[model samples]
Target chain A: MRTHHVTCDDDVKLLAALASNRDAGFEPLVGAYQRRVYGLALRLSASPQDAEEIAQDTFVRAYRALAGYGNDQIRALALRAWLYRIALNVFHNRVRVRRVPTSPLELDDGDGPAFRIEDGDPRTRPEQTLIASETERELAALIAALPPHLRVALVLRHVEGLGYAEIATLLDAPVGTVKAHVHRGAKLLRASLEAHNREEAKVEALL
Target chain B: MTTTNRTPRTPRTPRAPATPPDASLAEVRALLGRLRALADVDAPAALLSAVLGELGLDAADRYFSLRTPVGQIFVAFNDRGLSAVMRGESAADFERAAHALLGRAVHPATEPPARLVAALERSLRGEGKPVLRFDLRGLSEFEQAVLLKALEIPRGEVRPYAWIAREIGRPRAVRAVGTALAHNPIPIFIPCHRVVLSDGTLGRYSMGGDQIKRAILAAEGAAPDVLEELARAGIRYYGSDTTHIFCFPTCGHAHRISAAHIQHFASEAEARAAGYRPCNVCRPALGA
Candidate 1:
């Protein structure tokens, strides 16, 4: 999920076109929000394939909903918060049926992007890349394995940098409680990171 | 200090970055930053079209305006087949009406070209192969049956609402049959104008009233004056004196019957009493 800059004014333009003319500006809307929506799904689901499916479904549902809105109603929307809410619902609904448990292996593509960059760059230090990749992968896997409520809140808070207000709207929880849960989740994450680092020191002693 | 120090292995936290923006520890910030950066995957190049395909938007409902016997009209279709044909004041009006009816957007047709009009005109005149496929998707099963049966009326010929109702095996739905034909989305191509009142009068047409219906029928070689005359004379069925078969006045077999050999019956009972059976070709009603 590449960071996309779908400005509010741009969204208003797209919404105005879509509202006045059914389906107009839809492709561009998808273009603008696809990265953020896909990124949100990928983090929530921890699988690239499920992320793509969820992203596509989210946009499809958005299209159906936006078609019925008048210009002003559509223009007033905060697209990121709204789209993230839809993506969250799509992810949960899929999980309710598929019952896929989040395990460490699912985070293989969650953070470590070295496999793709290996062939693309020649100046890269393979040893340095390997160490960095291992660290990020371990951290991502830890985040992915968090309890659902904590994982979602923490990711929305720290990983995605969404404010508490938007996070509340997405998770449908009150702001104060969500902040506490995210802080508790962050503590658990730090403890896990420290424990994993201690294990690495023990392993290195043998080498 | 030297005796207490152990040889160092590879650094444990290779992910320490320039600065942790938040007050969170370096590893936590790095992990979240990487996740945020991965969002730049650009959503795979194929995803936009895949989303459109899922929303049923990739398959464009292509339409084009054309001039015909009835004047300018809109023809809309999709990969399924022709969905609508009607008159509109402008292309925008046509597009809006199509959206309201089909619940999807329509775009201008890029294919089908100028030759499409000629082929359809020939098909309507019974001179070309039956290449036109009517997309009657939104119609009910009964309405689809009614329209498809109406399609078999043979270009210049006419049938009654009751003929369609009976043909579709819903004899009591004669008025419903009229309603279906009246609301035929693809009018000229579906040829709803061919279905008239059982009394042989030109029925109301949703396209542009009876005058457009009469003109289109005239173009297809069904004479309006003859239909009017039959309506005035109260003739509901035409029979061949030699074949002893009765049909709707517009049936091809009845039209072929010579003036001297033609027989007109005011009612199906009269035709039955005269020993004439309903024509197998037109499949006229056996009961009242």
Candidate 2:
């Protein structure tokens, strides 16, 4: 369901193909969006097995739904956003049913010394290098720690490069709420990374 | 400035200025850029097959090509029935078309299942009734009707498209009947090629064009050369001078007559005017 920039011409072509030939047209649709959907599921579920099942379920559901859609509806559909919405719904339902606890983002109080890191001064900013030095696994773990709603909004905005309005439409929330969620999510991520960097530096100094 | 207390407090360091919003956002963007690598996760190739299986489609359908007398013909079928038969097409083309129609990729087998092999042989030899099942799931009602009627045209005999239309009670829908036959998915089983033009000429065919149509008809004991010769000579119906019966040139009973005893007529009126009755076997007057 992550939004990508599919062209209007492509949408028309795909819709036409689907309308006339569901089986042939569906292959290209799956080829186009499978990876992105799988990636979103993986990031959301944080389990490869669950991601695979979720991705498979998303396409099957989409195929069934599109089979009943009229030509005009298919032609006018925003495929990327529509798919993301379905995937997000599937992911959330699975989470609820399984009662799986997503990693939580924990923010220390501002009284922590890491909060004193200056914004404007370039000399005090080692957060970028610290993040760069971390492994991809660690970075994914950090992203996984965000709250579900914020993580979705943040990932859609940053990783997927979707606009606030598009994310709002997908999430069925107000644009203002989406913007606030993304902003707060980013703030928390930066603070958590900064605190981790400070702790690492302390350990290094002790050594 | 407030007056200093007795004991000078340790110089309080000014709190570091808050990180610039733009800088923090840039940091988040950088982190997200790293996460973008996860997008390359390839869903297993079997995922599509899995989905097709879940939908009860033909993902597990078996297919094989047999080199018959006419040409190389590809056939695909599932437990439900034989779904498709295409002539002179490559395996890839057959697979693609099958997938498009059935919503699943069919696997090509080195040898067809025993039952299918037997059915194909019987159908090719134009022998006894072959017991192969047909998967006509997506065909329109008219197409199914036309094809089902076409199946009644016995192995060695051919019927005109008009005959099919009239048989279906849509006598005026001859063109529509042709279109429906042309769209027939399972060709040999449906036998669309057996339907010809009203003038006893081999009409347009959906399989491998008219030539293959002629070949299949010939293999079924219909004389393609005789039909072509009669069409070329502007003969619509052939009348027997001795038997006093008019029959299609492609008819087996008519084919046995010598050219000396045969009287050719372009119109049914001309044949009837000459005191010839329609042959009960060929039924040429049905379309004439």
Candidate 3:
């Protein structure tokens, strides 16, 4: 998702206003975190409608919980980690109620090269722009198709640029486990992309 | 021999070779960066309002419109309950007045909550007694007392302003009672329409003109035509042959009397002279 970078200063201002029960603090807080929160939700749920509900619910729940906090409590809070935790909880609750499994990676069991390099860089050649766009789309699909637990760790680590310790804190897991999930998730993603490329080459040969 | 063996052991050690970085790992990192840059959609514009509404914050001091037989009635409310009910006023005018009265900004809701709509409908239909709560924040103690006394007037019945003033133990404040009714923030629910002039004429109402007031009274089984006829003819009292009780012309029982069995008296003295006692219901002896 398009990342709208939130500055540290903005978080400080938002937290201060929220601590004092000021209404003006609400808009800025929403603007600062909406994109990242929405992005994380969309990646988790893979449904725009579900993502919207989750995002709205996350902000609402945060607002209510913050309302009861004293100034000191709000000041000491880590807003991003707290918000992500809330969003994750909301997503898990929804998944539990729906009783549907997270989207699984569509790949056959096969061994392939760890990486493949095309002869020419697509961005350098306008003739290969369409192929490059297709590859990007495929990459997004592969990410979305990761198992829920691994996807969460991978997204937090790579997409959100979060460190393993931070992800462990957010997920309430041990740091070692978080690191392993990210590692295995990346390996599986690479394998699935390789398999997909092989199928595409086979189709081209037949054509 | 020991020195030669030590020298040979020292020469046998070699440094371990360094491993190179995987190009595949770099490609995967680049793909993740692209995914992070993908455009995500924003939440719906109404979502913030909806969230506030769900939390009961936006509704704290808001106006909601309801369709009624008279017209669209706008009722402003807060957490306490209904603050004001209005009609025919522009939204801006209503907002200004509500802000002055409630000391908070008032926004117009597309429609009121379902339970409120049902309560209003039942009140309008004059169905079973429905208890309605009100904010009445800006009203004075005397005004609140007058309005609360007016609530005692049953549906399909009208009372004189003096009756409300007397009921509130402020008999000399009859004009003040009128003023309070004129400023009633909640009209239909509190039922200011059930109050009339001492002369039995339907009084001016704040919600709409007197015509709307008359219609509301008629809907409640109070016959405006009969009351108007009696007022025009200067009839102060009516004697019912069935009950042998003379009552004020606006009395519910008095309105039922057939012309053949009806006797009109210009004054309570005339009715008493005719051997008719004052009806306990309307008490014509009290006189308007």
Give the TM-score comparing model 3 with the true structure, all chains together. Answer: 0.46
Clashing pairs in 3: A2-B38
Interface RMSD (Å), every candidate: 10.2, 12.9, 14.6
Q: List per-model TM-scores for chain B.
A: 0.79, 0.70, 0.70
lDDT by residue (A42-125, candidate 2, tens digit) is 666655567778888998899899888987787777888888899998988876886756453333445443222112123423
Candidate 2 residue pairs in clash (backbone atoms < 3 Å): A1-A83, A1-A84
The order of the candidates by lDDT, greatest first, is: 1, 2, 3
Off by over 4 Å in 3: A1-3, A22-27, A96-99, A102-137, A204-207, B1-26, B39-47, B59-288
Distance from true location, Cα of A117 in model 1, Å: 25
Over B136-162, each residue of candidate 3 has an lDDT whose tens digit, in order, gives: 756899999988888877787777888
| Candidate 2 error regions (>4 Å) | A1-5, A19-28, A67-71, A102-134, A191-207, B1-29, B35-42, B57-60, B64-75, B78-122, B125-219, B222-253, B256-260, B263-288
Label model 2 with its docking quality class: incorrect
lDDT of 1 at A19: 66
The residue-by-residue lDDT of candidate 2 on B200-239, one tens digit each, is 7898887778888988888888778877787788888878
